[model samples]
Target chain A: MTTTTTRTSTAGAASTRRTRSSDTPFVTFEQANRRLKWALLAPALGFVGLMIAFPLVFTINLSLTDAFGAVNAGNSYVGLQNFADALTDTRRFWPAVGRTVTFTLGAVVLETVLGLALAMLMRKAFRGMEIVRTILMVPLLATPVAIGILWMLILDPTNGIANHLLGFVGIPPQEFLGSVSQSLPTLMLIDVWQWTPMMTVLLLAGLTTLPEEPEEAARVDGANAWQRFVHIILPMLRTTILTALVLRGVDALKTFDLIYATKGPGGGSDFEAETLNVYAYGLTFDYQEYGLASAVLVLFTLFIVAIVVVLRRRTERSAS
Target chain B: MTHVLRPRAARGIELSRRSFGVLAATSVLAACAGSPRTASPDAPLRVLAINHVWTQAISRYLPELEERIGRRVSLRMLTADQLTSSFNVKLNASATDIDVMTIRPLQDQMMFARNGWIADLTDRVEGDADYRWTDFQDAPRERSITAGAAVSVPVVTERPALYYRKDLLEEFGGAPRTLDDMLDIALETQRRSEGFFGFVGRGQRAGAVTQWSSFLYSFGGDFTVDGRSGIGTPEAVAAYEFYGRLLHDAGPPGATNMSLEQAMPIFAQGKAAMYVDADAIYSNFLDTSISTVTDTVGFAPFPAGQAGSVPHNIPSWSLAVNEFSLLRDDSWEFLRWASSPEMVARLQSEGIPGARQSVWDDPATLASFPADLAEAMRINAANGVGHDRPEVMQVGRARDIVGRPLVSGIVGEDVASVAADADAEFNDFLVRDNRQQEF
Candidate 1:
């Protein structure tokens, strides 16, 4: 017992001496470098913190105020009055929210379905496959504002080629963007055209990474092409599909540029094309209702967060 | 860990280093973008102007104006929408990147003055003996004044007038002399003319307000009385209904989307017998490149309303010194010289409507435009009102309030009820803003 205690004390003393030596001027290059790396990261971390925290806090604070117009240039805090007003605002707020949801859902569903079809089409190797892929990406690369203007010219009721083409088929001219009901749907079609290529590329990558054993096994069992796609390929591509939906959905919910370019302020004529993003922008800049805009943005952010959480959970569950 | 490929690891390290460098450079670029490029006071005087034809004409004379003023002026032009939106942003934040800014006195003078964005040029105008402030047309000069202070220096002035086909009017017996006469002529011309409308003017909401105001005034309705909306009055409602009747019954197809930009070309193309629009677009009508009826187009005063022939003879463009600018004096110098009699004559000759009475009166300059057009301008300028649109800081909101009714009226809605609704909305806006309750 005495010998064992002496050995343990001696071992502890040796470790203590080693630890002290390690902390002194004889510190190794790797240890010193590790400490130095954190010092280097400090500024970047601080910058990112400032970038996020400042706006987050500022927006939250502003959301509680009644800051509107030139007279109320963001001073008097009204304590969730703006939020209450927005929550009950059937006229502007609720309508905008409905449009946002419809636009996002319409765009995402179309993009995902179209993207999958496109992915399936491009999965097999063929001559000029590169060219085909490049063609799909053309609209995505074009400036959104330019696209909007181009579409505007194409949809112009008086002189547009859309009406001209319809006239060829003996159909009456349609007010694609001009009509109150047609504007949002027309914008969704544009969005789908622009973003479907992105989803296709993402899904294509996922397809390439997917193991072919299950599909092959199903094919060997005399399963039809439809059966293999539904039972084997689809089950494997769930994560990729969910990822595409989340990506496309997030962007769709925040659509502003195309709407702004096409419709201008207050979302055209009678606010027909106004979604939450456009509504927020008009309030913030056009009318200078900063507080109300901030409230709307905050609510919009929470909504996005809630949606992403659900999507991410589903993605994780399938992955697991 | 078992077999780390040195070359591959080296490539990975190189890639990350390159990425880090790119990130750092991006950060630097972002920082630079956020910072405004400010010039020293002694540097060229920065004049932010709208990208209008008048401003384009002025751009040609900038070098000469700079030499005469003994200071170089750098002119940066933006579209009308950009100027209105961006200037408000910068001015509201008290940024002095811009020294002189273009303004529509009828639209923005009251707003700018209320916000203390523009310097009050009352004392300065009174002090500058050689500036010839008296030479400016009274209507525009009055419009530039806010709370008895000169906040805007008028440059390009315009008034709405009747433009008609000389051949058509001759065939129809004579020019319209009253609202009733004008409407009858319009109906007859529309019925008689093949593949052409009788009248063309702005019909879009917000856009139609100014053109509609001519009709509104003719019917003996003022915009406001004692800070209450005067649009709901019998005269105003009647005027709106009459306006609706003309457009709904005789104007072009898809007239709901037509503004002066679209309507002017329609008239100039001989598709319409008569057009009522700003004097600035007169040059467009004269430009043979686009106008089909340039030779046949004749100018006349607006047909008499109950208030007699009154059209808005207001400055389409004005220059204001930024109150936040350190170079206010330099900006004022540029403005004064730009709007001076000598410059006005040049500008007028160049086909930009000038604010100077002397420029319009000069026989040489007057000859530049048709004699009938010049006469119309002279007569209208003499009887011009102080403001065209609502005299309020919230001009755009007011226009929309007024425009909604105008649009509804044209579409065959109950104009009386629409006018009442518009009045209520306008009143609510004023009450909320704590501004003057009416236009």
Candidate 2:
């Protein structure tokens, strides 16, 4: 009681001093408090500016120049020439864009669907639920490169266990990642395998937080399990699903490690699995076409932003 | 008690804040001072190198180098791609930390040389008579020079050696000397029904180009002819078609996906009859842990085509002083010591081929290699072309362009049309690349 009284009195004395000093063009307590607030916020704002704003601005500027080979080397302003070149590059750029979209859509859609299913299946209390959840988390915890290598081993056309298992079932051996046509789809499946558990975990958390009254009411009204799930649970889970979609969708769109680890530069012999991320990486590091790479990156960033905006708008509309 | 302790807690926070500010200021001052132009007396000479056999072997004997230089030595090894990326990033910023760099002359030397990332070593290499720059093989020596300046010294030389199963080839009268005979043997022995392939090699577009360069040269097809794209030529088309046919018919399923890593294992596991790749990898076949065909493996020169057998004899890895190095003298000394005749001979005797002609000429080095492999290496080295990929500023891009036809052929697409398309694209690339280089 004495300590609180002493601290309060000290604060009041400080406030009185500030107020008295205000007549002499000195800062008042409000002004001082405002300044202190900004002082504390300045570092975080500066950090955000440095980390996010600077690279973005630098990349945009680089996109306008003919920067090649070395980052510190002399380069001339090429205007929109790099952008024009990238836009016209049917060889690598456009195909990469197509693959990126296809992969993201294929992988994210599959992951969301499967994740939601698994989430619901394990939502209620069940035997060995923790063990199953732990097992599911294993793929999510493993490194992408390690997972890629593991999948490569499992999917090896001639020598893999997958083929051996298929043979036991009297089925023909299939080239999973090795075939050009199959490479992208196989990688998508691998992505789905690695990331579905993440979605499941996220959705399961959302599931537990639900009021359960609506579900219970629907159940008492004698609605079918599928009807309740479709009409009630899914509608209630919109925000979580959209949030998970945005997370997994963006990640899938930028997938590089697994593809690079499995197929390597230019994404295989025919550039079969070259997504935009891989294409941009090849341009910057492998080919040293920094200008083109920056242009591609700028375009890629805009593309991602456009997607997030659309998704955000959809989420808002749904919420409203 | 709380009121009494308040001022003390405030004082403690103020002290911590002041200490942090001082530490930050000190760090800023230290950063501003930067690294010294000349390294401190105790500082280790840093060498950035690829994780190769030569690097592995030299690491064991680094103490000798350190003793000679009277300085500590720090060697860091990374994979080929990682090494290139590291150089690109570090050298671009003009980092002085890397005293010596291991580089691929054909792959990135042009870019590095043009960017002024590697120091010009003409005077050091030529002026030192004892060093005997001429003692290096002609092809690798020629490759080491970029833009008319000796920027690097060849250390590890590579040439493709035909790896074959001696047991499989015994009835076919040993390894084929001619391309046609090799194809015939491959086709006949490819028992896909019995789960064995007749031939296995790199088929991935970019990775295949280097190994295919030997085939291209043997077929009288260079990547360029008179500074123009030559892949459209009949010889180039034939080479592509031949390689495609060999892989498509005799190679294992999913051959298009196989690179050195994937294809080598197939041969090592006794699943393939013949494999053509860099001689540097011969040890993989002899290693008991990986190889099922250890006793059955045979080595031969690249098979003859329209032109006689000609393989790529390249300085697959070379030592160059980083242009921004603070310790150029030490770096050159390290390079000199590493590529010295005695050192080269010693390394070669242990089966890592050195660029020194004298070391290759010495029969003592040959004693360590499998007798047949040494013979094949001797032949291939003598009849080798200087480069394995298209010589251009953007080698990776050029390889991708040049390799498109190879993939088409492997997948049973028409070679001529694909070659024509690739040729046109490559020509356009060459023009653009040349324009970029001029800048």
Candidate 3:
């Protein structure tokens, strides 16, 4: 009994000695600061895991099954059939993908150029600059669906003030929302009007955070104002530009409310305005093709992720 | 490690338990979404209705209906469009927030019935002593069949009739009796009149489809016969050609964009010399807020084509019990009391059309009607057409493919070519939606 107790005490003493020696050299300030930063980041990591990662996993699972309308007993594990079908089907899935690409590309390109102009215009501080910025934020602050409705009323073919003004020019009544050929471009214009302000605000914020020293140096080195802006300010704002593009691109791809409010389900008779998001919505609600919709959503999410990754890489390259 | 993690682990388990409790409670409460079936006589039967002329009927009958049925009743209103696109989908999937649903046969009976979202009210309708199935009109009752079962109780019936300017017809020597006479008037009126459309009709795809269907049906043409597209035939092509010519010569430029909403306003503004649509619009003209040509308007049957005279069938909303409804007993009681002959009389007193044949024959009701309403009801009672595709399953897609493009064609799209386009779409829908099986 005494021998056994002595052996156990010896083992315990050895572990304590090891722990004491490890603690003797205190952590350096830089190391502590690095550890603290990571510690601070832990909560954000946990948040992303819960909000983004968990839902993504759930969505992936939903995509692989034939879960349909009313949540009845007919949900079957259909493997990758839904994904395969979505890639091939013409009724909604493929057309929606085309619409999403067009809308995202169209909206992003226009907003980027328009937003840059607005940002540059406001960059030079003058009288009422604050007031002009405040006015520019109105479209961004307006709810999308509400703005869509407001635009609808203004663009009404018969009763609208737009036609009333057009009549003065002898251009006979034109069907705005009522015409199939014109509806998509009309919706795009409305989207641009509402979201360009948002892009402008973001780019403006980025412009404010940019260092003035590089731009001043370029000006001193015999560069004109336009040349300095093109060579110096544009390169410096690359990260911010990429970030804005990615953020706005994702939202544009998923645009639902404005189109829905304007055209309604099946996207106004011919589905002229249906984006990928709207198509998924119609599948889930109008047709109750839940499995197909889930598949479409899953693939759409992948496309969005690919875009984000490419943008992120570009941002990293620009930083370097 | 154990000492440090013990409290944290304990708290995590407690938090999980609390969250589970909340979730379980929410699930239970959400599952029990509809009203309870077995309510006391003193409690009100929660009723859902559309806000229209129907509301007038409900308001008039509720006090007497409550006393007669020995149950208190209440109502909530929604638009017909709202019921289909948004409300029904939401109500059916989750807890049925509705007990009694007011629906149109076009959407409610067909679409809702197909997905098994609606209840099998056959037993309730057939077994109930107070329902009095024999008292119901044949045309309206026949509309309830979906998948070989009756799913709705029809409230009102509508038939197409001509609303021409009495002054114009008298000035032109007579009203049109057949398709030829109608064409003659159109040609003559356009030649004589300036800045006026001789024949005003909806030319927008959705609206023009209705106009085309009437013409097609009148000429013995149809979308399907023996479960195949009835387009690409001589008679169908001839009908399409006639409609195209009529619109090209007599209808206004840019008529392709015109809809019922646009058509009504134009007709009311005296820009249209003649108009044809459902009988329901007669009341719209009477409404002080809308019409300027109410007094000058005259009524006639839709012009007869070669095979038969086509009357556009505009379906009114019907009352149907939700299958998920727990308040089946109260719902049936309310339906019976509200739809009875006596109740219909009260409704008719306020200009709400009743679905009963008896109400149609009532002398007081007949005497109370304006000449236009009386003429419309007489036509409706004698012969009113329903939808060609009455089956509840995928009829929506079928209607859109067949009807929408036809209407679009009216607005200067090639009528013959577009008719072919519509036919192809119809054939595809019939095959894909399993509509062929129904035939």
Per-candidate alpha-carbon RMSD to the true structure:
7.2, 4.2, 6.9
| Model 2: pairs clashing at backbone N, Cα or C within 3 Å | none
Among these predictions, the greatest TM-score belongs to 2
Candidate 2: lDDT of B287? 99
lDDT of 3 by residue, B84-184 (tens): 65544555454445567777776456656755666677887788766687677776787776778778787765666677877887876656878878877
How does each model score on lDDT?
0.78, 0.90, 0.69
Better of 1 and 2 by lDDT: 2
The lDDT of model 1 is 0.78
Q: Against the true structure, whose DockQ is highest?
A: 2
Candidate 3 lDDT score at position A98: 83
* Worst window of 10 by summed lDDT in candidate 2 chain A: A1-10
The TM-score measured for candidate 1 stands at: 0.85
TM-score per prediction, in order, is 0.85, 0.93, 0.81
- On a 0 to 100 scale, what is the lDDT of residue B195 in model 2? 68
Tens digits of per-residue lDDT, candidate 1, B160-242, equal 88899889889666678788888888888885223478887877777788777778877888677677788889998998888
Model 2: per-residue lDDT, tens digit, A5-108? 23356676576456544643223344445555655665786578678998999999999999998878898999999999999999889999999999999999
- C-alpha-based local distance difference test score of model 3: 0.69
Task: Give the interface RMSD of each candidate.
Answer: 13.6, 7.5, 11.7
